[model samples]
Target chain A: MELLNRAISGTMESSDIMVEIIPWDKDLEINLKSDVKEQYGKQIIALVKAILDENGVKKACINLKDKGALDFVISARVKTALYRAARRSQ
Target chain B: MFDNFSKKYIYSQNTRGRKTTSDFLKTLGLSFDENVNITINILDGKRIIATASAEKNLIKCIGVDENYRSKGLMNTLISEIISHQYDNNIYDLSIITKIENEKVIQSLGFETICETENIILMENNKNKFKKYLENISKNKVANEQSSAIVMNLNPITKGHMYLIEKASKESEQVYIFIVSEDKSKVPFETRVKLAKESTKFLKNVKIIEGGDYIISSKTFPTYFSKNVDEWINNYCNLDLKLFGKYIAKELNIRKRYVGKEPYCELTSFYNKKMKEILPLYNIQVTEIERLEKNQKAISASLVRKLAEEGNISQIKELVPEATYKYYISKED
Candidate 1:
C-alpha cells in the first residue's frame, strides 16, 4: 500500500517502539535505533522489512526508536502505522 | 522501585498538571521552563518522579528523581519528548543541556553538535549538520583568510551594509550567516530576504542561513533563564565557540566581524564577550563603529518601531534601499 500522509504509532516508553512513517519517493528506508545494535539490530531490521513486504508497502521512510522491544511489538507497530498511512483505493 | 508509576502527557490546552510539574522540576535543580507547549510527567500516584518538556523544537526541563536513577526512566522521558515532537511533524529537535547532564541525553540517540565547558547542544537528526556543512562549504574559496559575520538583521540597515562592506574590503571572502530563529516581529524569511537583497552588490559576499548552529541574540536558551545575566555571557561564548570550532574551520574563516553597539547594553556586552573569546580561537575580531546619521547610530529596533507606527520617511535614512522599499510597499 502507498502512504497518503505521514503517520506515527506507538510510544517511546520502555519495552515499546515508536514508529513513524513518511511518504517517500524513492526506495524503502528503515532507520532503526536500538541499544542492542550488535546482537539484534539485523533481526529487527529483517522483521520490519518482512512486515512491509507482507503489506506491499514501498517508498516509505520508516523511523524506529527501539528500546529493546520484542519482535512481535515491532511488527505490530509497523503494520498499524502502515495501515493508517496507506493510500485509499479509488 | 519502578513498579507503581503512571505517565501523563500535559500540554497547554489542558494544563491540569502544570503546577505540579513546575514544582517537581524546581526540586531537581531545573525550572518549570516557561513557554513549554508540551510536557510529560511520570507520576508516583500524584507525586512527580520524572519529567521532560519541549517548547517548539527545543527541549528543556528534563529531570528524574535522584532515588529513581538507573531504572530506565530517563530514557523513557527523552523518548516520550521525541515522540511528542514527532507527532507535531517536528523531526529536527534539539536540547541545550549543561555538560553535567550530557550522558543521559546522549544515550537517547542525540549527537553533540557543539560542546563547551558549561553548555552542550545536541540534536536527534544526524543528517542536518552534515547537509549544513555541504551547503556552506560550496562557497569556500581556496584562501583560509576568509571572514564571517552572523547577523540578526531585524531589517537590513545602512549600518549593516557599512559593516559588510568593511569585511568585503579586507577579507579574501566574506560570509553573511543570517540568524534563523524567528522571535522578532520581522519573520525569519523576511529578514533573510532583506539581508540578501541589501548585499547583492558586494562582489565576494555570500549569504547563508544560520540553521541550528548560529545562536541568535533573541533565543537565550530557556535552560539557563534562571540565571539571566550570568547565562548571557555563557550563551554568547557558546555561539562564538561554535563558529571557531566548526563553521569557521569548514569555510576557512580566519577573522570575525561585528558592528559596534553604541546602544543596547546587552549587545554591547555581546561585543565585549566576542572580543575576549574569539581571540582564543585565533580568529581575529573587528569591531566597526556604527554607521550614523544626525550624529546618532542608526538602530534596527528604532526602524522597526517607525515602520510599524506609520513613520516611513523617518526611517529612510536608517535602512538600505531594499529594506526601505519593503517597509514603504507595506505602508500602502
Candidate 2:
C-alpha cells in the first residue's frame, strides 16, 4: 500500500514539460486514471505513448489524478507518478 | 510431393509435441505451453520448412543449416511454397531471421528492417501497402504555436480519449504520433486508423504517423525481452534524439502533450527519463492523471482482453462512447 503526493507545476512552452514526482509510500502499487476535456483523444493517447515509449513499459500498475492539467502540467504529473513508481527503495 | 509443396499442411488439432506460438511469443518474452498443429512445407525433402499456423495472417519463420548454402535448395523450398500461399491471399507474411542473413532474403525480394542488432525484420515487398503519416512535429508546418501529442496505443481505449481531448484544449494545434511496429497485438495501421476516426472531428488536431525510427521494433527493440536494460537505454536515446527536442524543433512547435500511464512500470520509468531529457531540448513534460474505471486505471490491454472475450459491454465504461463504438464496429 502506497500513496503518491506530487506537485507537477509548470507552464507550457517549447514542446517541453517538466514534473516532480513525490511518493508517500514508495512501495504502493500504482494504477492509472485519466480524464481529458472532450475532443482531445488522440493527443492524450500520443502523450501517454510517448512516455511509455521512453520508459519501455509494457505493463505496470499506475494511478493518474487529472485536474484538466495543461500539457505541461499533464507532463509533470505523469513524470511524478513514474518517478515514484520507478524509485529504488531508499 | 512437389505438387503438394505450396499447399499448407495443418497437422490436425491437438497434435502431440507441436508448438504454435513458442517462437514468436519467445521473442516478446511471453510463454505458453500448449499443443498447436504445425504448418510445414515439404519440398521433396530437399529442404525442411516451418510457418506460423494462423488462418487470416501467416507468419513464417525459416531456418537452414550452414552446410546447405548455395545449393538453391532453400530457394526452391520457399519460392515454391510462399508464392502459392501469397496467391491464395495469405497476404500478411513476415519472415524472422538473423540480422546477418539478410543476403539470402534480399535476393528473394525481401527488404530487411532491423528488429534488433542481431535480428532482421524481413518482409516481402511484392504487395506491402505503405502508408506514410508525417511526424507533424518534424514538418515545417509554419506554425510556432502548434503542439504535438504522441502515443503507443498498444491497444486504444477510452481513457486515452479523455487525455487527448484535454491536451487539445491547451494547444492551438495538436499532432498525434502513432507507433508503427508489427510487434503490438493490434496492428499499427489499425491503431492509427482508430486514432484518426476517434478524433476526426477535432478541427485543429492532425493525425501524423510517428515513423518507426522513434518507437518501432526497429527503433526501441522489445524492452520486455531478455535485454530489457539495453532496450531501455535505446528507448531513452531514441526519444531524446529523435522525438524530444529534434522533432519539437522541426515543426517550430514549442508545446507537446502526453498522458499518464501508471499501470505499466516501463511507462512510469519513461515519464521519469523524459523529464531528465526534456531540459536539453527546452521541452516541457506533462503527466496527466490516468482515467479510472471503478477506481482502476483504464488500459488498452484490458479493453483488448475484454474485446477478445466478446465482452464488449465492459469496455464502454473504460473508453469514450465514440471510441467504444468504433472498437465494437471494427472488431465485430
Candidate 3:
C-alpha cells in the first residue's frame, strides 16, 4: 500500500507508542525510541518491519516514540498510522 | 493516561487565555511569553495542568504541572506540537529549552545544537547544522586569511560594495552572509539578488544565505530573565560564539569584517562586542571606515531615505548599478 501524506497515530502515554509515518523516496527506515530499547529494541523493530512488509510498504520513514508499549499495542498504532497515510487528508 | 485530560489550542486572539496561561506557568516558576503564536494547554476540566507554546518555529514557554511529572505526559505534549508544526509544512523546528530539561527533550527526538550555562538550543532533525556547513563547504577555498562579513543589505549600496571589495583585496577569500530574517523594508530575495549582481565581478568573494544560525535581534526573543542591557549583550555574544565556534571553524574564517557605523548605536555596539567576544574563539574582528560620497558616509539607510523622497539622482550616486536600477524600477 502507498503511504499518502504524513500520518501520526497513538500518544506518548505509558504503554502506548506514538507512530509517525512520512513518505520516503529510498526505503523503509524505522527510528525507534523505547524505554525498553536494551531489552526489546530488536523485537520491536522486527515487528514494525514485518508489518510494513506485510502491507507492501516499500518506502517510508517511520518514527516511533515508545514508552514501554506491548507488542500488540505497538502493532496497532503502526497499522493505524499506515492506514491513515493511505487515505487522503480528511 | 491521566483522566479527563483534554488539550486546548489557545489562539492569539483569546483575551482570557493570557491570565490562564500565566497562572499555570507561575506554578512551574516560569512566566508567560507574549510572543507566542499558538499555545496549547492540557487541561483537566477547568484547570490548566500542562502547557507548551511556540513562537513561530522556536518552541518556548514549556511548563507541565508539577504533580504530573514522570507520567509520560511530555510524549503527548511534544508529539502534538510536532504534528501541529508538520501540518504547517514547517519540518525543521528549534527549541530554546532550559539547561536542566536537556536530556528529556533529547529523548523526544530533539538533537542539541549548542548549549550555554542556561539555555540549550535543539532541533528536530539531527546533523542539520552540520549539513548547513557542508553545503557551504563546497565554496571553501584554501587561504591564509579568509574573512566573513554579515550584512542585512536591505538594499545593497556602494558602502556595502566598498566593504566587500576591500575585504576581497586583503583576504585570500571573502564570504558575504546575507542576513536571512524578514524584518527589513527591502525583502531578503531582492537584497540577495542585488548583493550577487553587484559583486559578481569579484572572483574571491562568495555570497551565502545566512540561515537560522544567524540570529538577528528581531527574530530572537528577549526573555532571557536578565536586564535589557545584559540580555542584549548575552544575545550578541552568544550569536558571535555560534559563528566563531561553528562557521568560522568550518569555513576557516579567521577575520570578521564590519563597516564602522557612524550612525546606528546598536551596530557600533555590536562591532565593539564582536571585538571582545570573537577573539576568544580565535577569530579577529576588523572595523573598516564606510565609503564616503560628498564627504558623508554612504549607507543603505541614506539610500532608503533618498528613495523615500523619490530622489533618483541622489540614490543613483550612493548605490550600485544593480541597486539603482532596482530602486528606479521599484519607485516606478
Return the lDDT, model 3, position A60: 93
Off by over 4 Å in 1: A4-7, A21-32, A57-63, A87-90, B1-24, B32-35, B44-49, B65-71, B141-144, B225-230
Question: Which candidate ranks first by lDDT, i.e. highest?
Answer: 3
lDDT of 3 by residue, B148-171 (tens): 999888899988989999999998
Interface RMSD of 3: 2.0
Top-down lDDT ranking:
3, 1, 2
Clashes of each: 1, 59, 0
- TM of each candidate vs. truth: 0.86, 0.47, 0.85
Candidates' C-alpha lDDT: 0.82, 0.54, 0.83
Worst 10 residues of 2 chain B by lDDT: B126-135
i-RMS of candidate 1: 2.4
Q: What lDDT would candidate 2 get against the real structure?
A: 0.54
Per-residue lDDT of B1-332 in model 1, one digit per residue for the tens?
26688888998876568888888877865677667889988888878899888888888788889988778887777767776786687878888877887777766767888887788888877788778878778878777689999898998898889999999999889999988877777888999888888888888898888887787566666554467676777788788887787778888888989988877788788888888888888889999998888898887888988988989999888888989999888878
DockQ of prediction 3: 0.60
Candidate 2: residue B62 Cα off by (Å) = 16
Residue B318, candidate 3: C-alpha displacement in angstroms: 3.7
